[model samples]
Target: MSRLELAAARLAKALDDLETVVSPLAKARESAAVAETKIAALDAEREALVARVATLEDEARALSGLTEEVEDRLDGAIAEIRTALSR
Candidate 1:
C-alpha cells in the first residue's frame, strides 16, 4: 500500500478507537443529568408531603381536643343521671 493509504487507514482506526473510549463517558454524563433532575423533583415532592403532614397533625390535634371536650360532657351527664336514679 502507498504511504498515503496507510496514513488514511491509521487515521480511521484512531477515530474509531476514540469513539469507543468516549461513548460510555458521554452516556454517563447524560444519565447523571437525568438523575439530578429526578432528585430535584423528588425534593420538591418531599417538601410538599412534609407540609401536608404538618397540616394533618394540626387537624388531628384539634380533633383530639374536641373529642376530650365531648367525653367530659358525656361523663358529667352520666353522673347526673346516676344521681337522679339513686334518688
Candidate 2:
C-alpha cells in the first residue's frame, strides 16, 4: 500500500481505539447522574417523613393530656357516687 493510504488506515484504527476507551466512561457518567437524582428524591422523602413524625408526636402528647383529664373526672364521679350510696 502507498504511505498515504497506510497513514489513513492508522488514523482510522486510532479513532476506533479511542472510541472503545471512551464508551465505558460515558456510560459511567450517565449512571452517576441517575444515582444522584435518586439520592435527591430519597432526601426529600426523608424530610417529609420527619415532618410527619413530629406532627404525630404532638398529637400523641395532646391525647395524653386529654386522657389524664378524663381519668381525673371519672375518679371524682366515683367518689361522689360512693358517698351518695352510703347515705
Q: In TM-score terms, which candidate is top?
A: 1
lDDT of 1 by residue, 1-87 (tens): 999999999999999999999999999999999999999999999999999999999999999999999999999999999999999
- TM-scores for every candidate against the unseen true structure: 0.83, 0.82
What value does the lDDT take at residue 1 in candidate 1? 100
Per-residue error for 59 in candidate 2, Å, reads 0.9
Clashes of each: 0, 0
Q: Candidate 1: what lDDT? A: 1.00
Taking every candidate in turn, the Cα RMSD to the unseen true structure, in Å, is 1.7, 1.7
